[model samples]
Target: MNFVSTRGNVSKIGFIDTVLMGLANDGGLLIPEKVPQIPAERLQAMSELSYQELAYEIFSYYVDGEIPDNELKELIEKSYATFRHPEVTPVQKVKDNLYLLELFHGPTFAFKDIALQFLGNLYSYVSKKTGETIHILGATSGDTGASAIEGVRGKEGIRICILHPHGKVSKVQELQMTTIHDPNVLNLAIKGTFDDGQRIIKELFADVEFKNKYHLRAINSINFVRILAQTVYYFYAYFQVAKETNTKTVNFSVPTGNFGDIFAGYLAKKMGLPVGKLIVATNENNILEDFIKDGVYKPGEFKSTYSPSMDIQVASNFERYLYYLLGENSEAVTDLMNQFKSEGKIVVNEEQLLQVKKDFAAHGVLGEECLQTIKKYYSETTYLLDPHTACGVAAYEECNEANDFCITLATAHPAKFNESIERCDINQTYPIEISQLFDKPQYLEVVEADNDEIVRKLEKLFSFSTR
Candidate 1:
C-alpha cells in the first residue's frame, strides 16, 4: 500500500513514511496509490461485527504491510476503548429517514476524536518501532486542538504543539487546549485567522531543516492515518443503517470545514462501501458550496459564526479532491493550487467542474438556520444538537429528499458550545467534567504571523527544556 503525493513530484512512499510526512515535499497531501475494495461478502457480514471488529476489517488493507495483523487489531481495540461509548459511533433516528450519527462520544466530545485518538496510538507505535522522538504540529479552528491535545498529552517520546487563531474559537474550546499544562504540550494563540495558522504549519513543513531539527510530524487531516481512522465510522454507520432498515445506499451530510470528514466518505465509496451522495454542509464560510456549484474556488473573510469550527476559508484537504478530479495530474493540480494561493481564487476548467458536480452536493446555512434546526429538533423530536450538528441538519434539507435514509453527522456535543446552544433556547447544561475545565488557568503564547517569531519561540522553549 504505497502512498503518492497529490503534487505528483515526490517519490511514492510506504505507509509509515506517508504517515510521518503529513504533506509531501512538493506541498501536496498524500493519498493511497489505490483505494482497496471491500468484498461484498465482507460488507454484508459486517452487520454482525462489533465496532472494533468492523474497524479492523475495514482499515486492515490500508495498514497491512506497515503493522502486523495482531498488532493492528490491538491498536484498533485500544484506540476505541478510550471512547465513552462502547459502540464508538452510534446512530439515532430523529425522524422517519433522518438519522443523527453521534460522533462526539469521545474524550474531547468532537468528531475529531474518532481519528486523533487512533492517530495518537499509531504515532506511539511507529515511534517505538523506529526508535525516534516526534514533535507534532497542528493548526485547528476549534475541536481539532482539544482532540489532538487529548490524544497526545502525557505520551512518551512525543511533543505536540497546536495553533488556534486568537479570538476565533469559543472560550471552552480555548480552555480545552490551554488548560492542559503538560510539558509535552504547547499551545499557541496565533494573532491571525485559522488560515494564517495553517499557512504557518505548511511553511514549517516546507522548511526541511526546521522540520528535521524539531522532528516535526502532524496530526492534521493532511496525515493519511487520520483519514484512514476516520473512514471506519462511515462503514460502521452504513452497516448499522443496513441492519435496521433495507436501505441500499445511505447519504451522509457532513458539517465540514477542513473537508476531512466528508473526504473520508469519498474514500469509503472508492472502497466499495454502498454510500450515496456525500453532502457537504457549510456554515457562513461557504467556500466549498461555491466551488461545487460553480467552477470558482475563492477565499473570503473568516466569519465568526455560531459554528466556530467551520469558520474556515481554505479547506486544506480540497487538494486531494483536485488530484482525483484532474485524473491524478499532480502537476496541473499543483499549479492551480499555487495560483489559488497567490490570487485568492482559481477557476476550474470545465472537465474538472463536471466531476465535482457528479459526486458532491453542497449547501450553506447561516447562524439563524442553525438555531432554527436546533429549535425544530427539540420541539419535534426532543433531540438536542450542538451548533455544528444543527448546521448539518439545516443543510440536509437543501439536498435531495429522495434519498430517504440520510445520516447527518453530529460533529460535537452541545456542551462544547454551551453559549451558542443557550442562544438557541435549548437550555442545555455542560457535563461535570466540562464544567470543571472553566476554572483551570489557560497557559498559551500569543505570537504574530511571522515565521521567524514562531521559530524563535520554539528555539527558546527547546533551549529552556534542555537546560
Candidate 2:
C-alpha cells in the first residue's frame, strides 16, 4: 500500500519508504493512501488467534510484499514475547460499564512497548533483508523514550538516540533511558520542553541530505509501522471483549497526548472493527479537547501536570487526522497548518466540526482530579492506576454513563509515576533501582529552539563519531 503525506506536497510513497521517512518532507505526517478493510470473517476469527498471529494478519496488508509472510510472522512472535503478559494487552473491569485495558505489561512498563518492540523487530527484519544500517531518532515526553530504548537496545545494525525534556519526565522514566549503557543507544536530555525536543527532531528529518547521510529513521509514532503495531491491540481488545462477554460494540477511552493512540482506534474503525466510541482523554494540556469541540486548533503553553506524558500543547499526529477530515485534501491541510503556525489558531468550517464531534468526544481533567480518581478507584474497587490512567478514567466517567463495555487505556505502570500515586495517599514505592536513578549522572546538551542549533549539534555528533 502507498502512503501519502498530510501536507499534500510530497509524492506518494510505499510502506518501507514511509517507515524510513518518519516525517514527510512537507512537514506533515504520512497516512495510508487508503485505509485497508478487514473482512468480517477475519474480525470474527481474531478472538481465537494469538497476539503474534493477529498482528501478522493485520500488518501484512500494509507491509505489502516487502517482508515475506514467514519472516513477518516470526518478527511478530519475537516482539510480543518480550511483553510480560501472555495476553499482551489484557482488559480489567474497573466499573460496571468501564474496563481498563492494561497496556503497561511490557518490558518497559508503558503502552509504547506494545508497538516499539514490534517495530524494533520489523527494523531488524528489514535491515537483514536490505543489508543496511539504521539510525533511529525519537523525542519522548516520558514513556516513549524508555520503551524505544528497551526495544532497540543491543540490536545489531541499529542505533537509537532519544531526545527528552531534561526535567519533564519522572526519575524512573529518566533512569530507564539513561541506565541502559548499550553501545547502540544514546540518550540526550534536551534543555527544553517535550515540544522543543519534538520540533528539533522534525527539523532534523526535514534535512533530507542530513537524513540520508546518516541513514536516519524514526521510532516515533510518526513512523506508520509504529501505528500499525499499535492497531493490533485495538482489534485484540475488541475481540477479547467480544469473546469473553459476547459484546459487539466496544467503546475505547484513550488517555492521549500526541493523538497516536486514539488515531489507532480510528484506523480500527476504518478497517471495519465494531468500535463504538473513540473517547479522547487529556490532562491540563487540553488543546486536543478544544480542537475537537470547536474545530479550531490553537496550541498554548505546556502545563506540567501529574500526567507528564500528556503535557503536550501541540500534538504532532493531529495533522494526519486533519488530512482524513479534509477528505485527503493535502493542500487544504497545508494551508490550515500554516495558518495555525503563524496565527496560533485555525478554524474549521461548521461541517468539518460536526464531522469530528460525531465520531470523537474529548474531556480534560485537572491534576487534582487525576489524583482523586486514583484514590477513589483504589479505595472503592481495590484497583491501582497511574496518573495517566486516572485521566482516562475520569474522562470516561464524564462522557459515557453506560455502555456495553468501555475500555480506558492504562497507559503506564504505576511504578513509573510513584510520586503522583503516593501523593494520592497510596502507600506504595517503586523498585530500588527506580529510587536510585536520580543519583545517576546524566549526559545531554542544551540548545535554543532554532533549526540551525539542532542541525549543528547533529552534524557535530555525526562528524565526531566518524572521526
Candidate 3:
C-alpha cells in the first residue's frame, strides 16, 4: 500500500520510503493512502492465532509490495521473542468487567518496547538490504528514550541520539537511558520540557539540507512503523477478551501523552476490532482529554507530574487522527494544523467534534489520584501500579459505564518508579532484574534547551565539523 502526507504536499510513497522519510517534508505526518479493512471472517479467525501470527496477518496488508510475507513473519517472531511472557502482552482480571492489560513484559518494562523492538529489526533489515546507514534522532518524556535506546543499541549501520527533559523523568527512567554504554547510543538531557526536544527534532527534519547531510531518521511515533507495531497489542488484548467473555465489544483505557498508543487502538477499530470506547486517560497535561471531549485543541504550558511520561502538552499523533476526523480532507487538516502551530490553538467544527466523541471518551487524573490508585489497588488485590498505569485505572473507574467491559493498559512496571510507589508506603517488592539497573554507571550530556545548542551538540557527537 502507498502512503501520502496528511498535508497533501508530498507525492504518494511506499511503506519503506515512509519509514525512512518519517515526518513528511511538508511539516505533516504520513498516513496510508487507504486504510485496509479486514473481512468479518478474518477478524474472527485472528482470535485463534498467536501474537506473532496475528501481527503477521495484520501487517501483511500494509507491507504487501515492500516486505515478503515470510521475511516479515520471521522478523515479527524475533522481535516478540525478547518479551518475557509467552503471550508477549498478557491480560489479567482486575475485577468483573475490568481487566489489566500487562504490556511491560519486554526488556525495557514499558509498552514502548513492543514497538521499538520491531522498528529496530525492521530498520536493520531495510538498511542492510539497501547498504545505507540511518542516524536516528528522537525525543521522549520518559519511557520512549530507554526503550528506543535499548532497541537500536549495538546495531551496525545505525546510530541514535535521544533527547529528554532533564530532571523530569524518574531516577530509573533516566538511568535506563544514560547507563547504556553502547557506542551508537547518545543520550541528552535538555533543560526544558519534552515539547522543546520534540520541536528541535521536527525543525531538523524540516530542514532539507540538514536532514540530507546527516541521513537522519526518527524513532518517534511520527514514524509510521512505531504506530504499526503498536497496533498489534490492541488486537491481541481484544482477542483474549473476546475469547473469554464470548463477546465482541471491548473497551480500552490507555494512559497516553503523544496519543500514539490509543491512535493504534483507533486504527484497530477501523480494521473492525469491535472496540467499544477508547478512553483517553491523561495527567495534568489534559490537552488530549479536552480536545477529544470538546473539540477545543488548545495546548497550555507543560506540567511536571508523578507520571512523567504523560507530562506533555503537544500530542503529535493527534494530527494523524485529525486527518481522518476531517473525512480525509488533507487541505482542511493542513489548515487546522497550521493554525494550531501559529496561534497555539484551534477548534474543530461541530461535525468533526461529534465524530471524535463517538469513538473516544476522555478523563484526566491528578497526581494525588494516581498515588491513591496505587494504594487502593494494592489494598484490595495486592497489585501495585506505576504512576502512569494508575492514571489509566483511575480514568477507567471514573468514566467507564457500569457494564462496560474495560481493559486498562499497564504501560510500565511499578519498579521503574520506585520513588513514587515508595512515597505512599506501598511496601512492594520489585524484581531483581530491575534492582540491578541502578548499579550501572550513567553517561549523559546535559544541555540548555536551545536549537542551535542542540545542533552543535549533535554535530560534535557525530564528528561533523561546525560551519
Per-residue lDDT over 271-390 for candidate 1, one digit per residue giving the tens place of the 0 to 100 score: 999998899999999999999999898987778899999999999899988888888888899899889878989898888788898889999999898898898999998899999999
Q: Which residue ranges in model 1 land beyond 4 Å of their true spot?
A: 463-467
RMSD of 1: 1.5
- Backbone clash pairs for candidate 3 read none
Cα deviation at 425, candidate 3, in Å, is 1.1
lDDT of each: 0.87, 0.84, 0.89
In model 1, pairs of residues that clash are none
lDDT of 3 at 249: 91
> What tens digits encode model 3's per-residue C-alpha lDDT throughout 1-467?
88999999886798899999999989899989998998888888888999999889888888975887789988899899999999999999988898999999999899999999999888888878988777889999999999998888888778889999999999989988999997788899999999999999999999978887887888999999888988898989988988899877999999999999999999989987889999999999999999988889998878998899999999989999999988899999999988887898989889988888998999999889999999998889888889999999999998899987999999999988988998789766767777787889999999998889888877766663211
lDDT of 3: 0.89
Instruction: Assess the local accuracy of residue 80 in candidate 3 as a C-alpha lDDT between 0 and 100.
Output: 91
